[model samples]
Target chain A: MRIERADFPTSVTLDVRAGQPLALVGPNGAGKTTVLHAIAGHLPIMIGSIQLGDRELVELAPEARRIGVVFQDFLLFPHLTVADNVAYGLRMCGSGRKPARAATLPWLERFDLSDLAGRYPHELSGGQAQRVALARALAAEPEALLLDEPMAALDVEIRDEVRAQLADHLRDFAGPTVIVTHSAADVAALAADVVVLERGAVTQRGTWESLRAAPATPYVARLVERREE
Target chain B: MTPARRSGPAVIIWVIAALALALLVLPLLGILLSAPWPHLPALLVAPETLQALGLSLLTGVISTFCCLVLGIPLAVVLARSVGWAVVPRRLLRAAVTVPLVLPPVVGGLALLLLLGRNGILGKYLAQLGITLPFTTGAVVIAQTFVAMPFLVFAVEGALRGADRRVELAAASLGATPFQVFRTITVPLVAPGIAAGAVLCFARALGEFGATITFAGSYPGVTRTLPIASYLASQTDLNQSIALALVLLVVSVAVLLGLRDRWLPGVRG
Candidate 1:
């Protein structure tokens, strides 16, 4: 997948290859999530094109883009049970309720969320909700996956465990994955390639170790120091 | 018990509050006290009273249905017009709210000017052999015109308060825009729609001015319960009071029953 936007002063160009997850790390207002939203076809780019394979994604509506987005808050459908939420995409794609439920069983087992199928989002813990969000996103078999601060909503006590589980899920999905985050720990655990975005532009791009060795911006240096700590 | 300890301002505030409460409660007390208790059952079952009650219910239901069919989409459009230019959005809002504040009689007159037999649109409609004024259809139209704003406002508030990100999430999950509206947006605001429908129905049930001006009350055809009460007052004072008591009871019952269940934010 390739994205190029040149309309604004802070133009951004990004490329992600299949089976290789990339982390876009930036401070708040650096437009990390905006990039994710643009890729997912939620926001319009004034002068750019987003291409997934040979298809032009910029001209397509969000649903037709076939991208999975795990929002910062997880955003589990509060009115639906865990099972229905996971099966929503299948149902939307024209699967009957029984068939969708049947298809969702493997995802439930894979995510270890079988026991929570009947429960609603409000009844789940932070970690449980994250797993359900991931399960829901991946169940539709999207061509690309975007996660916005996947571990941001979890408590400090469970962040490590959930992060490990999330890393496993991200690795298992064979697609171009982009994780937008501000945390150095997420970079260390989840992504192999790092793109440091500041003020809506990419400041540095490299492996975590290489970026640590030669930090290009003050934000990158601070991030490297924090990771060392 | 602690009257002596109360400050002067506190005592004055309490007295003023009590007076305000009495101002609202006194009229309801008057209605109940003046009701003819022994003849109340017979008065309620009277043919004219039943006909008026039945007409009121039918028109109220039909008008509320019309409000829902028309008003929900209007509310959704108004709520989602956040990115629109300020002037147009404001104009749209003002148009929706005009009927809410406009005198019901004036609203009826406006409808008449648009749909009456000799009026602009009505003249064309008459050419096609369709006349609206002084008909049961006119009562439904008048009630709908007056009460639709209540539903629009309620549903608009609900739509605005709902998380747009959830809809975005649904979109990213491969649900089309219309699918998201049906499966997510509507369910998220279902309670608000229910409350709005109830308010609209109650407003329609109590509709008098517009119906009288536009539909011109006729026994068993256009005369509703409120109109029946007003007409009965000139002939039999006791029957009028009984009809009013019935209206009061029904309205109070509906509002009270739904308030705690649907509108937790609305409290004394």
Candidate 2:
């Protein structure tokens, strides 16, 4: 995946190789989610292009971008049951209900959500909801995945467990994955590489170990301290 | 902490509130007290009464359906118009609100000028051999014109209040814009739509001015229950009160039943 845009204070350019996950860490209002939204085609890139392999994603509509986005809130459709939510993408792709449900079974089993298939989003725990959001996004079989603050919505006690599960899931998918988060723990657990975004521009790019050894900015230093704590 | 004591202003406020409640309730109380209770069954079963009742219900239902079909889309557009220029958005809102505040008789006159024979669009409709005024269709049109704002405003509020991020989530999941709207947006606002529909139906049922002015009273054709009740007032006061009592009961029953079933957190 490649994103190049010049609308920011400094030109922002990013690349993630296939099967490699990158975490974008930034302070609040640093435009971390904006980067994910641009890649997912939810926002327009005024002066640049987003390319997934050879396909120019910037010109496509969000639905046509073949990019899965797990939003900060999970955004599980409150009206749909767990099974139906998982099956929604397939249904939208013109699969019959029976076939969609059939295709959703593996995802449900993988996420350990089979028992909760009939339950609504309101009934799910935060951890379970996170898994459901991941399963729902992956079920669509998109070419790329963007997760905005995936662990932000979970309880602090469950974040580590959910992050491990999320990392496992990310490994199983072949697409380039980008996670927008503030936590250094998320970077350590889920991403192969870390990109520090500040004020809509990438300030540093390296593996978590390298970033920890030599932090780029005060914000990065604080993130490293928090991780140690 | 000790319970806050009611001040002198609070006592005065409570007294004024009771007076306001009485102002609203006394008329309905008078209707109930003056109704010919013993003769209600006989009066209600009369052919004229039954016809008016049936017409009112049929037109009310039809108009509500019309409002849903038309108003839901309008509400969606209006709610999504937040990105539009301030002047245009305000103009659109003001246009929608006009019928809500304008006198029903004026609305009827507007409809007449627009759709009545020899009127603007009505002249062309007349050329097409489709007269709208003084017909059953006119009653429905008038009712829809007056009652649509209720549904539009309600559904618009719901649409605006709905979490739009969920829609982006759906789009990211490869659901087309239309699919997201149909599967996610509509279900999210279904309760609002239901509440709006009930309000629209009640408004349509109680419609008197527009129906009278645009469609005129023609017994089974346009003389709905409210119009019939008004006509009966000139002849038999007892029968008029009886008809009104029927309207009051039906409206209350519908509001209570649907409100409890669909509108959670709205119960008294």
lDDT (10s digit) by residue, model 1, range B102-219: 9999998889999999997999999999999999999999999999999999999999998878999999999999999889988888778989999999999999988999999899
Of the native A-B interface contacts, what share survives in model 2?
0.79
Q: Is the docking of candidate 1 incorrect, acceptable, medium or high quality?
A: medium
Clashes of each: 0, 0
* DockQ of predictions, in order shown: 0.59, 0.63
Please give the CA lDDT of all the candidate structures.
Answer: 0.91, 0.91
Second chain alone, TM-score for each candidate? 0.91, 0.94
Candidate 1 matches the true fold with a TM-score of: 0.94
lDDT of 2: 0.91
Question: Candidate 2 — which residues are off by over 4 angstroms?
Answer: B1-5, B258-260, B263-268
Q: Over the full model, what C-alpha lDDT does candidate 1 score relative to the true structure?
A: 0.91
